[model samples]
Target chain A: TTQEDPHWATPLSSFQGFEMIKILNDHPKNKSVFVHGKFRGHEEEAVVILEKTPFSEETLPFALSGETKLKVGLKNDIYGNYHGTPPAQVNGIKVSVVYPATPKHLVKYSQQQTYLVQETGDDYRNITLPFLQAEAFRIQWVYNILEHKQESERIVFEDPDKETGFILLPDMKWDLKQVNDLYLIAIVHKHGIKSLRDLTAEHLPLLHNILKKGQEAIQEKFSIPPCKLRIYLHYQPSYYHLHVHFTHLNFDAPGTGVERAHLLSDVIEHLEIMPDYYSKKTLAFCLRENDQLLAEFRKAGRVPQKSE
Target chain B: TTQEDPHWATPLSSFQGFEMIKILNDHPKNKSVFVHGKFRGHEEEAVVILEKTPFSEETLPFALSGETKLKVGLKNDIYGNYHGTPPAQVNGIKVSVVYPATPKHLVKYSQQQTYLVQETGDDYRNITLPFLQAEAFRIQWVYNILEHKQESERIVFEDPDKETGFILLPDMKWDLKQVNDLYLIAIVHKHGIKSLRDLTAEHLPLLHNILKKGQEAIQEKFSIPPCKLRIYLHYQPSYYHLHVHFTHLNFDAPGTGVERAHLLSDVIEHLEIMPDYYSKKTLAFCLRENDQLLAEFRKAGRVPQKSE
Candidate 1:
């Protein structure tokens, strides 16, 4: 019964109009005649082919001279569901078809028509996606520096919080003087957390310990008073790891601009008031033109595409 | 014996020349002729005047007409010493004259003639000298802030060693975050010691105390680590007061550039090695176009005057 089914006999639709007949008859010298139609709720105009032979009036739902075939392509499932790869998973994509000439609704339907579809999974990878991967690799390299114990000698102080292992070390490059011209960095041991985006109110105690322990160590080591010290974090950090920067108020290190630097105290206060503050907030930061993350955002419809 | 004084007679030659004659004869109506020439060992051109009628042919070694009179006005002493006030008590100056018409050798000599002299008190003051006075007033205002105890609440730390009383306070304007973004200014009680030039090995213990006490206070208050702190001083301070700056290394504050900032530890170490290190050093700093200090330096021959 499944073999004799009318749906299996031909790949074309049962609805036959004069345009369908004209298309079939006009292209007799050819094996197939392609007609435009919406298939399986996919409103994008699809090309359906009509075979010149195997015409049987007894089995056919429409009295046509030939059998029809739905040429929706191999990647599409039987129900005309598109399972092909997409540009990205985050946003919907628009598809269109331009018909040159068709007899059905000759004037009104002669132009172009478009449709939308939701993207998923690995479909999101694009040419710019490689850049995001490269950045991830860079962050990985910095993380490995700690794992290898290369900075063990440089560690000025450390807190024994196994969950958020905090450590302090002098920055490698210092433009300020060596005596009181001290520059230091504080970082967390949690590898899962990347930046402020991943931080929440629960991590407040760890941050507090880092700042407190760091201040104590700096006072003991460098002989700088608390009032003279400045501690803050960069919004778009140079590296993706969760870290804090401690510098002298007089040093004016790079990335201390209002747009980039976020004070640790303020961040703490903000979190105290609103637990998910950073997560809900829309952050603005400078990005190089070649940054693939920006391209991915553009492709996902999260940001507007740059003009040529 | 005073009547035979060679200095009082012509105000001319003990120094010989005819450019003196032309200077005396050119201003015919005036009884006094002011001609610039060197007197004493001082080489800067001094204003000298010659009188005509009192000229005894016996007193005058050279012949001159009865009509020739060149009497230069004087606020100077009989010994040719200037008593006018100077901007600062340092350096010597050079002066020159350009004559429009004279013989070829005299003309050539006139065009390039220049002499040097030590400036007397207040003799070097220009119209812009008022600015230097204003800056002194500004320093006095800051000093008064400490005296009146206006910053008592803001005084995070203080070390009383009588000779070098040290007090630390927050900088009024701060670009760094306040949590750890505290900017402290540590000033010496001895206001007479204006800059690093006044520092010597004798003040090392006082400086050491300031750093230590300030650090202890900061650690107790803000909980920032000593490794995270930075401390330094500016060479040509914004004001004429000896002060050290303590801040976080992350903050890129004004006057932190290599040309302006000097490390407190380096300064102390330098003093330990050489007591007069700062004073002996020829410090270079940028002066704004309108800075009165630059004008004073030019007048003192410490620096060359820029051509108009």
Candidate 2:
């Protein structure tokens, strides 16, 4: 059955015979056990997630074992996840192994995600423009990748057209495992289009091409259909390169928050109606307290200086 | 100390002598057990949350109880929560019990959140406006409360200005226990203004008054400074009549997703810059698949007919 089916319970149970590789994460309060280990007799590591189920009506009543009873409260009892964390209504740590482990998986699973703010058009003109003029963000690595000097083998699809073509590859954040938490990036061959602000009616064709081909390629490789894909672009992206993110609708990938992510379909439609929509519109986003962009805004007195 | 302090681990522990009240939620996979009991000798209920702490670097390795080993894999290994899940990096569920939970608290913490889509101005014109014209939503209860026919004692703040004044009351979603997951709604004293669409430059005084007085009132009572609060409005709001939401910045309240939430600060600024901003601009929001609004969009041919 497809992993997207909400009722499908992950199948890799019984770690009794599994060979251990590395512990990705283990926690008690916000409890999770992520291990990069191989199921016994397997050649390489398989991506599996282990979680200690909550005490459900069926299982929790049997929880007392004569040992010294200890107590706890997770550092974060956060309950605001909009994605609707699954109904974890049922004990021992459950396990389900997926794909192979990669170095990228290590970093992706480890670090915390950054919270972003919306940067309005006023911000675009007043702060983002000046920040870009200063060329504060570096994209040498993007150029290197486009030129095939780096991560060349990772490309899943490539359209060599310099104007509308792009190289599709697994983002460093994707673990190259099964498709549920899938993430991939498509970088356009064109160099002048640095970010969302650089797009115009002239680049709509390029955007469409990425949207179409990126979705098509992922489906071709992973059997996920286009309708199931969530394609979008990031404004004030981590890098200056013009790239598109392709993720499964079920994945709930990061950086897709409304404050930062602009749906490619909405954007294409916007530019369709007004060719200069991006050029004239005010975009919004959050700037970190210590970010250079925030500093630029503060320097111009558009944002308040740090009182903290 | 203020509950907003992230450095603080929740204080109430040792359910040891606590009188059991009711089980709010209990789960093994999603791993959360929310109880609604009170401290043993206390007269009134004080909120507390209990979570089994994870096996920390200092703890986990000693987890061998050598009991009957059962295993699992939670139904959801969801990793892409946009709101960062704290570093759950380290075993038994820990426990934390916060303020006395109200019936509202039970409702608030029970059901899962709904994922929303950004509704553009076109949606407002084609689907939302038409839906509103049909008066598909119910809000007679609001009128009842306004007339002091119901829940009169719940009003936290009220200004009698028909055009500019409003009444602040705890949203049924707030437990009225503590300030952290605080949620409140302010309904305008005037009745004609239905939703965000009805506002024009003429209402800036009202908007400004709500922003100023609302902030002041909350600060006066809760000690949460303006910067510590998140004040906003929801498009396609559950009920209309132009209500504004006031929540603690740290609460991570639901319906605050970008697609649905509009910052009061941004709204005020937009109106300040252009009186007819709401009228001229297209606002976007998600319509549930089965929502009456979606039916309106499809009937108008503004959205595709569902094949499903």
- Could you say which candidate leads in DockQ? 2
Interface RMS deviation of candidate 1: 51.0
lDDT tens readout by residue for model 1, B118-147: 122232233223444665546666767667
Q: Quote the lDDT for B205 in model 2.
A: 93
DockQ (Cα-based) for each candidate: 0.01, 0.12
Candidate 1 residue lDDT tens string, A82-176 = 11111111011011112222233232222221111111213223322354446553454455446644546567887756676677877643322
What is chain B's TM-score across the candidates, in the order shown? 0.53, 0.64
CAPRI level of candidate 1: incorrect
Per-prediction TM-score: 0.31, 0.58
Which stretches of candidate 1 lie above 4 Å from their native place? A1-135, A175-180, A300-308, B1-308
Q: What is the lDDT of residue A173 in candidate 1?
A: 30
* Candidate 2: Cα lDDT at B160: 85
Q: lDDT: which candidate is best?
A: 2
